[model samples]
Target: MNSGLNFLQTNVNKDFTTLKKNLKKDFTGLKKIKVALLGDSATQFLNQALRACAYEQGFEFEIYEADYNQVSRQLLDLSSDLYQFAPEFVIVFESTQKLQHKFNSLQKSERLQLSELKTEEVKNYYHTLNRQLKAKLIYFNFSEPMDGQFGNYSNKTSFSFLYQVRKLNLELMNLSQECKNLFILDYQALSAHLGRQMAFDAKMFYGASMNLSIDGLPLVAKNCCDIISAINGKFKKCLILDLDNTMWGGIIGDDGIENIEVGDLGNGKAFSDLQQWARQLKQRGIILAVCSKNDEQTAKEPFLKHPEMVLRLDDIAVFVANWNNKADNIRYIQSILNIGFDAMVFLDDNPFERNLVRTNLPEVEVPELPEDPSMYLEYLSALNLFETASYSEEDELRNKHYQQEAGRVIAQKNFTNEDDFLKSLGMTSKVEPVNKFNLPRVAQLSQRSNQFNLRTVRYTEEDVLQISQSENYFTLTFDLKDKFGDNGLICVVVLKKEVSALFIETWLMSCRVLKRGMENFTLNTIVEVAKKNNFKKIQGEYLATSKNGMVKEHYARLGFSEAGQLWELNIENYQTKKSFIQLN
Candidate 1:
């Protein structure tokens, strides 16, 4: 077993045994989220695993576990314990065998009808819960059986049990398109990757009707918590890699660039495959950084000159190759990136270097790599370190955008005065209401943004569409560009109209545009909108979270007076300040 997978398994067992150790501890002072886990079979072990995973990520989770095999009963009964708990998130885990059992008693034609009826029942459960309270629903899809009676031809036979389950999974995918709060947990993907035989234990299923084997329960639970954490805006944004033995086979300093092993031959194929994976991630908005203990010029040779290398100098957002301590190098990289330490994952081949960074900077996720290079990619995939909930067109250009920002930082050093530097950038912004064209990127920002978010509320594209159509709500997205490059969709602000006051429901901006006078520009726009709408004052609130402490005094700094926890700026007294940003 590789170190990453071995750690996951060990944590699963240790967490299950020590579940209550941090039940009441709130180290980060984040809100205690309430969650209910509803399942059709024995799910106590899964619940335990979720609690442990939540605590590991510094979230205080109040998980309400429903009775065994009582998913339908609790969802149907309005007065049941599930409704009384009033969870903010609901997870419904249903097993394939349970549905198969029902299909066995039905006729051949009734199988399709059975699938439709079950889907409708699940829809009704969501509708019933939404009518009573606001809860995001995570519905688990069916994990296909290992084998069917028809063998390999089961997919061609519509009447086969496997065919019915496959159709049901497709229906669930379609349902997610219509339901704004419904998210499908792809158990089929996880099971297919882990192999169905290992995923299900026949002895445990017959004895206690468990949905998964004891070994597989941990993976299911971990993935469930991973989805929840992503909803709460906890995910990795950067992948820092090492050069010598990690990215390729040999050292570029000792063996010349021509002698390095990176092509598709023998041991070199593994390194080439690893580079391909990293390049794909870079294209999809993951910031790539290089931290190696070697000469900087020597390290740059391969990316600059090698024909077989998949990654070039342009693909990296920050490249730091020096003889400094690995921990200190990561800190320097973090400073330039301006992201939280917890949002980084460092990959190095040497166990000594990994342990040194892990001990000094515990927040940086240094994955334990195996000795052999062949197992590197598989180990990283098994850890699932890069799971994301949303994507948009802007993701593809994120690396180039950040690289341009780095250039601006260097350009600012030549100018002595800060105002001169801001003026030199020739910054321009286009502020407009959210529309069909930019809805996906707007929603993506709401889901992933954490540090600069004032209220820390997440919304889907459907939710933003409703706000755009509503008369009482105002949705605005800001796109910024300077002389260097375009920072796509940099800011988002959602305002709700009260009788006399305009409430700032959501306000978040990209950290890349911080210290560039974007906040003053955004606030000036808000005041102009307020005056035109005949409002008395504008109100904003900052909900304190561990990640959003950087913006705790955001309103105060913008000249808004504090009224309890709410900040108010009277329209009559509002002063529209001149900004360097030219608005369009």
Candidate 2:
């Protein structure tokens, strides 16, 4: 029985029957989440598949499945079962078959307005549900259907079903961007990936109004679970690559840089394509690292000299190329990253190396490389390992941030006194309330920060925005900069006012800025806020999770006295803590 974190490390069975068997397994101790599933078509199979797939991902979903064709009623009525259940995620799966039926009933003039009307309907559903509940909306986009009425000419007309479906998909994307709580599930892409014949069963639809075939239910369920897991902050953040034969064809030492199969060389296109894909991932904020079992100079030769290489040295945050075991090298990389093993993915061509890493670091995701180099990218892409819930401008600069941290590490070795080293850095921090400018990064940190987080409460951008506008809540964001480089938005604190006391709702900081006395600076700021507002006391709590054990004694170490299950500090008794970081 693999834990949720280890399931993706190997190519575990995803067969529908196999997933169904997971329902019988012990679900004790799994993280419980509430989900409400509403579909126009029959959703019994989808509901079952979702529960089973969620079990494999280490979640026990308490699902509230609405009766068939109850999407509108469940969403519009505030006192409905959906509202009563108060689910964390509300999935709206509207079948394309049902959409086509609605389109066919419209007059020819109304047919031209089908996409617009349907988009508005979905927008209404989202807004109504959002106003009533804080649950995130996961709506499925329609898969394209070729009605053959206009044949190839449908591209020229807006009234055609094919044209309308494509327009509806685009409209849904636009709507999702406008509405922060709304998320569009790419059902169209999934159907295209599995092909029409396999995705939809005509006989099953005719008999039982099942839009998805039995074979495809597990995949659809898995996709839904992936989005949910990502929203909960369990997504991959790093990609570790092997150099010889994995990044390029042939051994770098034996084949030489010029003879390496990259660019227009032998079987070079596949390797080049993989590198291009990796570069795109890096640009999107996924940290890239190298863990190769070779001489450092030899492993770096191709990246430095090979013109066909898509990846450059600057693209990698940590590069470990030595004659040591790959597992130890990966562990070293993890240390520099300061992230959990579950957040990293290691790609290698050698089965022995992959197995060794899997056996030792079971939490690290290790995908099985196909025998043929041509199939590598295709297989990895299908896994969808890098699903993310949010993106910000700060993400693009993550590589540079890590590279600067490396410089700090080397500089620390030269100084003996910790105080002198800290003062030498000349660190400055800018503290401000949450606003439109930094809301995305604040919400992203809330989801991504785990180890240093006192209470692991994940929040979406919508949730953060609402809290920012509430008078009952006080928010603070910290931006750190030193002589080396800027570590953008390193810490966030949220406090809720209750009579004469301020309760700390959230206190999470990036692991990158840990041990720099940032925690003291943050606490000093929190105390300042409490005193300025005339609050008599401040209260905080530490909620333990599998990954946040590092901060279990955080309150105790910060001079907070234990009060029942909570930590408390009287504002009058609190003294300002000293920190090297100056407020800017």
Top candidate on lDDT is 2
Please write out the lDDT profile of model 1 over residues 1-584, one tens digit for every residue. 35544555653334344554555555476557899999888888777777766787777678899887898888788899999999988999999988888889898788767668778988898888877767888899999875558898987878788888888889898887777678888899888765677677778888987878766765777787787777777788899999998998898999888788899644888899999999999888899999999999999999999999988999999999999999999999998888888889999999899999999999998888867899888778877888776778889998898799789989999999999999999999999999989988888899888889999888877678878999999888999998999998989999999987999999999888999989999999998888888888999999987789999989989999999989999878778776899986
TM-score of 2: 0.97
What 10-residue stretch in candidate 2 is worst by lDDT? 1-10
For model 1, name the residue pairs that clash. none
Worst 10 residues of 1 by lDDT: 11-20
- Judge candidate 2 against the unseen true structure and give its global Cα lDDT, from 0 to 1: 0.91
Top model number, TM-score:
2
Q: Number of clashing residue pairs in every model?
A: 0, 0
TM-score of each: 0.94, 0.97
